[model samples]
Target chain A: MSWEKVFFALLIFPGLLYAVPTAWLMLWLERKFRARMQGRIGPPFYQPFFDFVKLMAKRRVLRPSFDSIFMMGLPLVSVSAGLLALALLPISSDSRGFAGDLVLLVAFLEVPSLCSVLAGFASRSIFGQVGATREAILSITYNLPFLTAIVALAYSAQSLRLVDIAASPAGGVRALAVLTICLCLPVKLRINPFSVSNAEQEIYSGPATEFSGPQLAMWELAHGLEWVALTGLVVCLGLTFRTGTWIGDFAIYTSLSLVLVILLTILATGTARLKIQQAARFYWRWGMGLSLVALILGVFPDIERFIR
Target chain B: MNIFSVLLKNLRMGPATLRFPEEVPYPKGFHGPVKIHTEKCICCGMCAYVCVSGAVRVAEHKDNCEWVYSPGLCTFCGKCVSVCPVEALHMAAKSAPSYFNTKALDEVHLVPYSPCPECGRPTPPVREVLRAKAFKGVAPNVLVKSLICQRCRQKDSQRALVSIQVKGEPPPSRSDK
Candidate 1:
């Protein structure tokens, strides 16, 4: 691969330049959708962007050495992981992905959660530690199905590279895997019903309780990028459409992500937050059931045909 | 109702909230700006007396009294409205009108003084409401007596004292001692 092409992939289309603005817009759109669902006039279109600027303009407060270090470093680390994952996803079918790129994408996706857990512990606060512990537990809980779904998709395609996965036509097994991934998105994004890790009421914003000023802004940016990465992954998987040009595919990707945003917002607005135990139970039962079925069908292709 | 149905209804109903720049409907008995009924005022200065913020000023002139109220300075405490002996001052039920300049928001009501009946001096005119209140149980002559200026009333009292004759035995006086 040429360095110029790699540079274009990392910093231009589907990179930081395109992803940042789209991330902010998606965040705004989700909030707007939630507001409309609740019969209220939501924020203006520029709210998320304005919020980032406002937060960045605030004065940074100094803290103890231990809490200080993580506060400075963790958001950078977390956001980098999210950005890298976004760049790796095959939003367009022409992405030059290699073997085991799916596994690498999954690893990059997990880094933010790991950083959040570490950030919580480093805060040296009761609420933060509780949040960190919940985050760790939820990570494990959600990953069971989350990883299994990706594995199932990889198995169905018979290749671990995202480009090959995109090349593979979706089947009944792939359909089940998509459903399994959909079930995990709410938890992955910290939306209600699965937001136990950062329960604002119970745990005071969870791991992010102590963050303020520009650090908090970074956290918010990371979250927005996470939206793009995770939803983009789903969109890339479920609707593998090619419209001749990358721009057309990019447009389709954006439109599908917004549609996904609306769906998630509805789910978030409808349900109250579940307790950590209840969330764990939910995943272990329904989520695990779907993932196991998909994995089983992938291992033995005869089962799906028998069911049909 | 189920959340999905509620969401659908909300989607259909639009927002129940008032939009930005739209004025909220005033509630009943909301305390608004101070307004004066010029004719009913007796120039007693009670509103001015009770005004903590000095929003109300009663300027007494020989020919007239100017009742000036600055809504910009008003704290909307409703004290002036409550203490007006002659129910002339009242709080408006609606919001105060917008003003380009706070200096122009001063409301001046003229309380003209009529010439006194007994003495030709200009005296603050009392309202009929005050008249009926003060002379509630008295006869018609009291109305005539009350309308005279204060100086004339004092002179009449002195003259009445001079005309009265002594009726009792005199006590031992210092001069006799």
Candidate 2:
């Protein structure tokens, strides 16, 4: 690809422009769906946009002890990582994918959480410190099962390239790996049951307590972009069907993303927030157990063949 | 609770959101903004006195009285509406739309006043004073007598007492008869 085309792909298509809006839509969908389930009229469709703008327009306030550079830079890093991860995903047959991009994708996915830890530490607030500590603990607890699930999927495809794994035919092992992904997703995204790091009631927005104005706006935007990237990962891994045309394939991918968002929203609404220790224990026990089973199943081709 | 059943039921019932701004039909008896009928206002300052938040201000100037309603400070308690003797104040079904500017929520109603007949001192708006007198069931002559300033009314009462003592309680006046 030409430099210009690459830049366009990274900055516009399947990048910031695309991911940000989709992420905002996911936020709206989450709120609206929860409201409907509870028999209440939710916010308007443009509410997310309004919130983003309002946050951006607010005056920036920083404590004297805060490291402004680190506090502000982390969210930008998160956004870049999310966009880079999305760019690596094969939305169409012509999309770029290098060997071992699955590992890169996983690294990119974890960078945002790492950034959150750094941001919390830099904020110099007690709540931020506590939030950072919780996030750091969560990262360690959730990363193992999340990586194991990906490894299991890679083992099933017998390739480390995302496109190859996605294009490969469905199998029993891949299905099990997909199930493991589903179980781990809530923890990774910090959905209701696993949202200990930023529990608003307990920690007051946790890492985000001290962030204000445009810096906070950027953090929220990064969060939205992260949602798109993660949901896209699930779509690529689980569905992965193509119609031989880029447009048709993208349409299928978009629909799969929508379905995943709806499913995630339902899961989020149905559960209560788990304490940090509870979340850690749950991930270590059930999440690890499921991914391990899927991993063992992926290792044995004969069993998958028999099951199919 | 089974989440799937809830989800299915909601889906069947359709979306719960109202298309607001276009179709926001306020519920019946909704305690929204307080409405003031300027013509019926008695300028008794009762609404302002009862307003716990001080959202309603009755300013009496030399020549005029100003009634200011600050919707921003209002808690929608409906106390002012209930306390209004002339039934001028009411809770409207429509609420004041949220404004980006604070000044937009302030409403000022200016009413001109009349001077007391005896002392020529400025009083509250003539229409409101008359309305209040009529609401209190005062006869026309007594209503006219009430329009004088407090000092002037005391002087007149003292003069009447002096005349009664001097004339040894003469026969009732024509109007009384």
Candidate 3:
């Protein structure tokens, strides 16, 4: 790929410039939607933006000399990784991503989470350490379904390129692949039911308990970008319409991502937080079963023909 | 109904909470900070006596009675208002504003003491409301006796007895001589 094209992909549409504002908007919408459901007036529309700015202006927390640099680097790394992951998405139809780019996307998607697990331990706070450990355990449980779903989609397309898999026709296997992946998003995003690690009532802010000021702001930005990058994946695979124009496809993608956000908000608002053991059981039993079925069908696409 | 139905109903019904923090209205029968009506207060110290939290304090000076009430110390139990003799203490409709200094939040009222006309001694002022309940338009002489100090009033009664004992004679009391 040309350096100019690579820079445009990483810095322009579907990248940092587009994702930052959209991610913050999505976060605010989630909070507002939940508040309304609970019969509250919620916050003003500018609340998220104001909060981000205020946090950025606050003084940084004093940390031990040995840990200050290590603590500050994690959020920066996560945010960079989150932005990199978003750039890999083929929101535009003329995506020139290379072969096995799906593996790159998945690898980039895991970076923020791995950094979070490290952050919790590096903070030297009891809450942070406990939150980090829970995050570590939950990640292991959720990745089973996440990886299998991607593998099934790749197998069905007979190619490892995300663009090819996204272009595949809709069918039972593709639908199941989407379902399995959807089940993992809540856990990955740390929303209700699977939000045991970061439960405010239980472990404070999970791995981010000790981070403050600019560090905390970066962590928040990374989380918002995660919302965009992950949900954008769902939007890519789920949407099939095309008007043979860039702007038209972009509009469709944006609207679908919004709809998915609303659906996720409803799911979060209606469900209560789950205990760690309960969350693990739900994933290990139900999630493991669905992922196995998708894997079986993926490894043997001819089995669908035989069963029919 | 499920959460969706409830959510829709709530959305249609509008928010159950106030839009602004200051917009929340005090509930009915909610007792707030104590407010004293300086005009009606007799400074009988009944409020201070009944206050369980020691929120109400009465300080008696030679010329005036100082009534101090701190909302911070007040339990908002309304006992002090109920025990007030002249209906002087009543609670405000809303709680006091944020507290920075405790002394600044105290509601202070200085009720002037009425001096006895005969001996220039300070006496607890009986307001019209208390006077109406204590005496029902008694004779002028009786009213005059109540208006003076006890020492001066007792001397007048003693002089009347001596004069009654000796007809056309001056009283034997040293002051009369």
Candidate 4:
């Protein structure tokens, strides 16, 4: 068998099963961590699974004149898009698609966000309307800073391919790229401040409000896979790896996943939610602007060289 | 002001719901319903008399042979216990009392009177002093006692009919005790 075929098959298996427990696990962990930080005991690890089952058993009732097919298709798209993103990302240097262009990776990342907006629009709920608006605004906000960081890295490396970027010299503005990526972490995870799409206080889970039964479960599963995919992208793009064996791949991916989960939980517990406008303003005014200046400074490495 | 304070506020106020299936300690100053012991009650109306809250009421039903305490009106005050001639009305220390509505709040009962076997009348005491006894901390108009006039008590001993005791203290227990 060809190496690419083996890698592709390997990726498919993990991505497909990723949603099964990942959804329940992330939800339970988030609740548990938040509870402990607040001096209480939260629900058990199985709580999310039980909740999914309960919601599934409820009678499937749609609103009058609602598009059932559109609503149903959106969640399926979310799950598949997230899984596809996971499969496309390079797990290690040896993995297939590591040679893929940075722009292709960006395109893959956009799919899940697109799915989120589509789900909101498809539901035809007022909350979904609000969610879709906020989500679109969020896309406009973070996608800039996020894309800028990737572009800065790509520019410095002199290649659009992710594997080539990893192969580049580490002496340039690599550290700056890493910092910006870390700051963008919350947005990519759909956490606080930028989490207006799922604002429970304002719109009662927004796009997810009307979605019950298996559809809700699928959406939640897609969310978890997105978390995993984002973390994998971060690890693949920047971190140096020593992967000679399958065990090494497993250990690295697992540790990275845990770190991302912990980072998100802490951020969620510690931060207050931001208004839609505040989120837009922060990303546009300060976050994206700071990174842009960093990118510009990084590219023209020295007027200082001439001055000195 | 800073991220730390904001986080602290969110953490403290956020939904960190408690685990159920295990008993939780009652919050401070939680007042549960008052308890009354029928055997120890001296029927002294002191609980009703001293009760400034008007939570206690006592009345007489003539046909029954016992005094009925409407614990619904009884406050958790030890005052009723303190004033009882025979220490009959004692408040139990169990404090958890959960209910669906406000009506559940004032409806506990203790009956000292029993219905007559022959006429179903709540038998009344022979002496005026004994008949005047009321559960402590109960309301004035809701106690179970004699409803027929003194003349009716004297004239009709055999054919006397029992009426529902609707006066004095209201029962504190909403459900059957």
Choose the strongest candidate by TM-score: 3
DockQ of each: 0.65, 0.27, 0.65, 0.22
Q: TM-score per candidate, in order?
A: 0.84, 0.71, 0.89, 0.71
lDDT per residue, candidate 3, B55-129, as tens digits?
999998877899988888989999988877678877888878886887778778898877888888876676777
Ranking by lDDT: 1, 3, 2, 4
Fnat of each candidate: 0.81, 0.39, 0.74, 0.32
Model 4 regions more than 4 Å off: A1-14, A18-20, A63-66, A98-101, A297-308, B1-29, B40-122, B125-177
Expressed as tens digits, the lDDT of each residue in A1-308 for candidate 4 is 37665455335434666445665676677777777666566788999888877766777666554577866777788777776666665555565444544776678778777877877887888998888878888888888888788888887777777767766666446666766677777776778856788888888887777788878877777777777777767776666554868678767876776677776787887778988778878877776876786577568767424544
lDDT of 1 by residue, A1-308 (tens): 47776677668768789889988998999899888889998999999999999999999888988778889899999998998898888877667777888999999999999999998888777898999999999999999999898889899889999988877876787888888988999999999889998998898989988888899999999999999988988888888557768889988999999899889999999999998889999999999999988899988999878888
Model 2 lDDT, full chain set: 0.82
Candidate 2 lDDT over residue span B1-177, tens digit each: 787788778867877656655776779988888878777775789999999999999988777778999988999999999988777888978888889886688989876666789788876644654556463664566667766766787998888788788877773342433
* Candidate 1 Cα errors over 4 Å, as ranges: A123-130, A201-204, A240-244, B43-83, B95-116, B119-124, B157-177
Over all chains combined, what TM-score does candidate 3 have?
Answer: 0.89
DockQ of 4: 0.22
Candidate 3 structure quality by residue, lDDT tens digits, A1-308: 68887788788878888898888988988888888888888787778788889989999878887688878899999998888888889888888688988999999899988999999889988988888898889989988888888888898889999888888887667778788888888989999978887899977898998889889989999999999999999888766645568999889888888888888988888889998899888888877788778778878878877898
Listed per model, the TM-scores of chain A against the true chain A are 0.97, 0.94, 0.97, 0.87
Higher-ranked by TM-score: 1 or 3: 3
Candidate 3 Cα outliers beyond 4 Å, as residue runs: B49-55, B61-63, B115-122, B128-144, B150-177
Fraction of the native A-B contacts that model 1 recovers: 0.81
Docking class of 3: medium
User: Which is better, 1 or 2, measured by lDDT?
Assistant: 1
Span of ten consecutive residues with least summed lDDT in model 1 chain B: B168-177
